[model samples]
Target: MKEITFYLDFVSPYAWLAFERLPQALEGLSYHLRYRPVLLGALLKQHTNPGPAGIAPKRAWTYRHVSWLGHSLGVGLDMPARHPFPPLPLLRLALECSGDGFVNRFVAGTILRHVWQGGADALDPARLDALRAALADQLRQDEDAPERAKRLLRENTEAAAAGGVFGVPAFEVEGRLFWGLDSLPMLRACLDGDAWFDQHWERAASVPQGLGG
Candidate 1:
């Protein structure tokens, strides 16, 4: 009966890519998922962590690496440059789906697919509405669909911000925070009773460049 709270913003390409593996990573493991929708730009302005795009050299390097990672993961991801909007509406849709006890993996999957598979305009309302229609059709839901979707998005975003989240694809396990989708494997390991958390003083060669407030 362990739990993981995932904080995420829709605008992040890395979050989309990370979502590709996280669901499966949780399989066969005892865990519950709590999704929190937060704003990435707000967090970036907080003087805490910097976005990957801020560092031209590192950003370039990460994109190349992400290309290879996507290939390995069998996920189709458009290059990061193409998708630059926040994923608030989409994440709200996911939360709304969860309320029905039918986690719309398709919506989640489509979000990932659109973001990484040469389909970079996933944030467009038209595209999102179409996706929602398809998902609702799949789920056979017909009541006030648009309104509900909007409500879900707003509520979740506010709740996410209130939860101390400043980024997307963040995972919290019983109060321990794991930011970024790349950290999911570590989160999984921690939940499965790994002792990686017991040690201290695992210092980096330098402070993460943007971590200075």
Candidate 2:
């Protein structure tokens, strides 16, 4: 079975959407989904790309679009009152559960669900404490868990950038990059061997006349 590396950040609504839909998309497939938590902000900085929410108009559209997508998918998504909430801590927490696929998925899903449903207070001290307690046994295994987690996140982000990733919800299948929640269909197509590229299709030559004179 081939591996699909799913790069994500909790701060992105699109990432949240991908999270909810990926399992179903890959259902009955021979791909193993490996979730890698990375700091989206760092990636954007490295790539010099602006975040969707950074533009006022795009931000407004994103909320509506993501909400509609969520509804269509039957996945509840309530935009956090504070969009772009600090995701560093959450990313670190996710990395703490790395290597254990089930635990990692649970932790990532829990954090994204909390932000999407509970809004800004998703990471309040009480909530964090509760989460920590829930994963106490796993946490106890590492003496410097927090620091180590932070380092892991940084390494993940760096690795992602090096791998040509510039945004959340990116997927890599056999070194082919698919970025965005919308790319799920394309990813699925690739997995099913039905994608256009699978047929050895080549890009048509661009006509110079088509370029601005």
Clashing pairs in 1: 8-168, 8-169, 9-168, 10-87, 11-87, 76-116, 77-116, 78-116
What is model 2's C-alpha RMSD? 3.1
Off by over 4 Å in 1: 48-50, 86-106, 124-126, 137-163, 198-213
Model 1's alpha-carbon lDDT is: 0.65
lDDT of 1 by residue, 96-189 (tens): 5654322444656665665566654767667767777766644435566556656656665566566666677788787667777678778888
Instruction: Evaluate candidate 1 by giving its C-alpha RMSD to the native, one decimal.
Output: 4.8
Kindly list the per-residue Cα lDDT of model 2 for residues 11-119, writing each as its tens digit. Answer: 8888888999999887888887778888899999887878777899998898899999889989888877777677887777777776432235667777778778755
| Residue 196 miss distance in model 1 (angstroms) | 4.0
Q: Count the backbone clashes (under 3 Å) in each candidate.
A: 8, 0
Give candidate 2 regions above 4 Å deviation. 99-103, 199-213
Best by TM-score: 2
lDDT of each: 0.65, 0.79
Decoy 1 TM-score against native: 0.70
